[model samples]
Target: MEGATPPASATATTPDAPSARSAPAGRPAVVVLSSLVARGSVGGRAVVFALERMGFPVWFLPTVLLPWHPGHGRASRHVPPADAFAALAADLARAPWLGEVGAVLTGYFGSAEQVEAAAGLVAAIKAARPDALYLCDPVIGDQKPDGSGGLYLPEATAIAIRDRLMPLADIATPNRFEAGWLSGLPVGSTAEAIAAARALGPGTVLVTSAPAMMHRSVATLLVEATRCLQAEHPLVEGAPNGTGDLLAATFLARRLDGMTSEAALPRALGAVFEMVARSVRAGSDELVLAAEQDTILHPMAQVTVRAIATPKPRAK
Candidate 1:
């Protein structure tokens, strides 16, 4: 973690509401804990901006700080001392305004200790407000071009996320590799992804970069308590990082605004797709978040979402 700040309350009555003063006036604030970058839209930066653009105030906690995403190049990396990080989290847990947190979304972590601290903070928030939602984006790894690379984060950090933070999450967002790694199952097809997601134990799971029915297109798979959904859109090649962070944050925002997973899935996917396409077309190395803020606020891209039917029971 970089700079620690006391969590603050903010007002947001509606999903499309305008920003107001930081207070416990209306909608509860969303707390985002992730990595921060000075020159890129990844981790907390992506999550915070998307949430705020959707009219929700955010309490941002940086798990680490870098000049840019590691993929860009090596830069100054800062992880707050474990003791100080735990202390800050404890302070947040005891804050009088804990009830103001309507939801939380955690992405990349700097260390295994941070994952444990995050679980404690999530528990505290749930205690203060029983209805609060927690979305965990297990930013552990991605499928490389050949789809052979393994976990990007250290094994200890990945294990901590799987063991400590994931079970606490109401919703889990992981890419194909992460889903397979976490569940110890193959996710090569839609059915495999659904089974793996269910086995991952979250009430709901969103698997990005899922296999799609449409050739050359990518899909986002949403496996919830009732049904399975796939939102398919064209895959953008060489797209910038942080789409996962953006999607998780936006989806959580929509859910907080009372949208079901069925409804939220498309909008969140559309926004991410639009942003990625636009950024790629513009040939930017990083996500063109500021230039594409309009997409986040009001996505115009069309994403086809279809409910995947469960097979009928076999004859006895």
Candidate 2:
């Protein structure tokens, strides 16, 4: 992995995931798969931040190291060549963290080779520790509209995820657009989102950005075989940059702590709403670091989290 300087402005000592609210919690180590843009986003940052707060040892295996973050145009960019996989494999061949490692959480990847490499890492982890949980947050695209179709995940990379990475994942977190692309389902409503999640080959699926068009709200849809759940929050009108990453992180953290999606879904949704509310209050991005940390301590401290019972399936 890479740890380069991205074009965006930098943050603190942690270099990549530095935030005051991001205190370390005594939890297991969760590895993040992404291109570490130095001092980048709360998506990447928040995951590492939140995990660290919970005391889970977090390590980032960036496919590339960016100067800043991908969210901002000014963030500098650096791509680790496709050949770096072998070196990564070798590095993992004898890292002490490998023995203590318990879970793997992958975010965005730049190249197909990186995707393959990430898969290799997952395989190695599982091989070494059979109980290790692999969580794949198919971080392709966020709320970008202009033809950045299907998560902005490269076609080849998407294929690799579907064919290789996904099945190995114990949990998969995908937003609306991503679920459509990954599961071949429609992205219109909550039901569609649930259907898409059910198709991803994993029992635990977290689908975000699922507010129905008729209502100006944000929705997180969770589907687990017979029991489906949905949580909705008032839509924040501006800047929703890093909620996906945060949600992915929150869900992973909760699950790692032995909370099921059914139970963790409410907490994750509350956290997302709290982050957005904090950002709006602070005049910042959708996922604000300071507020995010507070949300972790008190998810419901800001916004109320309500879980609605999912209705039974209707006749096809």
Candidate 3:
């Protein structure tokens, strides 16, 4: 809690007199808990950048730290001890500014214990501000090169996320593999994906890398109680990691800015698609977020959106 408190003078905001240096007024802060890569735009790095670029203040807590994404090469990983992580979570839970947090996004966890602490933090934030939204990105694994999928993290860690964090989430942004694994349903087809999404238990679920109706295209399906919407764009080969993290942050920021899920899906997908395309075109190993930041603010990428028919209940 050493740097938790701000000076009294810093607390005052001049709403009547705006200045170039003044912070954006009335924007609720978002708390992001995930992995941090020192030299990559993955995990908390991607999430924080997207939210901050959208003018939302962020309180980022890294679950693990690495020099870069593990996909690139071997790297040292650091996870805080359980006791210390829990203590830090406790501090944030009891913080005076907890009420200012409008949303919480949880991604990769270094350990099952960290997931437990994050669950507690999410509960506290909800209690402090009932309207706060929680988006859980189940970063367990993705489809492997062989077209098969499994958990990259320990099974215990994956289980902890499925059982502990997912239950508290208002929204879940899981890839096709994760959605299938978490819901214990096959997601090989659009219908199957929709069924799995409904089974996941969140009020809203976004299934990324969904089965696209059009060949050579990628789709993200936004599923809710009564409706399902799909936003699709042509696939970009060899795109870097962190699209999921970026998508979760972008969609959440749009929602907090008063956009409906229907409105947010296309915009968020467009931004992520544009970011990836731009980065790939530049032949960069990582997403060129700093160089092409304008895409995050006003993405001009074309995305096709359509409403999918919700599956009817099976008669007994």
Candidate 4:
């Protein structure tokens, strides 16, 4: 049957595996499980598109479907039933071509149970292909309107991500607030952010919106087992959603492309910074990812990166 046509149902069920004749040689697929919006780039759409643009085929699984981001006013939400979601995840986990997935990037979940399902799939992927990388973007909480940090998702959901997912991540991208919440340590200063990021279970943690050294600037702090790095850029007021998602996706793509964590930091940050600045200048509420595709491919924005001494633990 190598060259013969297969049955219609079998063809429908079978994944269209990548081939040297079709897909880019040596580029493995990225599986992105997160929220999906019909409008605006965020969650799975953001991750999938970023990876695809980098010439990687992406397997996208939507955790929840929305007309648009929740911030843009109340919209109809569709969260799949728990059992159905688990069944779908199990199906993917058992796929014959699962090894095609070289990395997984997960973000927002519709429910705590979905988090558990995602964890199972991650475990399965690792078991099937030990070298697979899992990048967990803990999208549980953020700073509140009252000028304080807190969890936006249900307490149980946050707990599931912290306990079940983060421990499995090779890389964790948490905004400053989520970092503080997950690490149970204050992240008000750069030192605190660096310490907390290291304490997080992942081998590498990228804390977006970390404290900046320059006035009117924001920073993305990367903490690893060996060292810590920071990438700071001027603040873009009225910046829109999807920046964090875009950053995480771009960084993962670059790392998969053979860049070191240190080497990839500025390039990924610069790309997002350029796209975000362009979007803001155009007065768009969403990232102009399509319009500024070149920026994503080759960032022209300026970003300054420096290494700081990793904070040592206090003596007992």
TM-score for each model: 0.90, 0.81, 0.91, 0.90
Worst 10 residues of 2 by lDDT: 1-10
Candidate 1: list runs displaced more than 4 Å: 1-25, 311-316
Please, what are the lDDT tens digits per residue for candidate 3 over residues 1-316?
Answer: 1112222222334442112132234888898999999998999999999999999999998999999999899989999999898888877776667667899999999999898888878877776677889999999988964886688899999998998888788999999999999999999899999999999889999999998989899999999988999889999998999999999999999999999999999899999999999999999999999999999989999899999987666677
Q: Give the per-residue lDDT of model 1 (tens digit) for 1-316.
A: 1122213321223432222212366667998899989888989999998889889989888999899888887778999999888878877766656657889899999999898888878876775676889899999988775857888889999999998887888999999899999999998888988888888878999999888999889889999766898899987899998999999988998998899888889889999999999999999988899998999979999998988986533467
lDDT of each: 0.84, 0.68, 0.88, 0.85
The TM-score measured for candidate 3 stands at 0.91
lDDT of candidate 4 over 1-316, digit per residue (tens): 1122212222233344222112235888888999999999888778888889888888888999999998999989999999898878877776666768889999999899998888888877776566789999999988943677578779899998988888889999999999988989998799888888887889999999888889999899999877888899998998889888999999999998899999899999999989989999999999988898888889989899999887555667
Ranked by TM-score, top first? 3, 4, 1, 2
Tens digits of lDDT, candidate 2, 7-113: 12111223232221222334667778765655645546767887786668877766666666555665566777777654664455235446467788888778777
Superposed model 2: Cα runs more than 4 Å off: 1-26, 142-151, 301-316
Each model's backbone clash number: 1, 22, 0, 0
Error of 1 at 174 (Å): 0.4
Error of 1 at 70 (Å): 0.8
Model 4 clash tally?
A: 0
Can you tell me which runs of candidate 4 are displaced by over 4 Å? 1-25, 144-146, 312-316
Clashing pairs in 1: 1-80
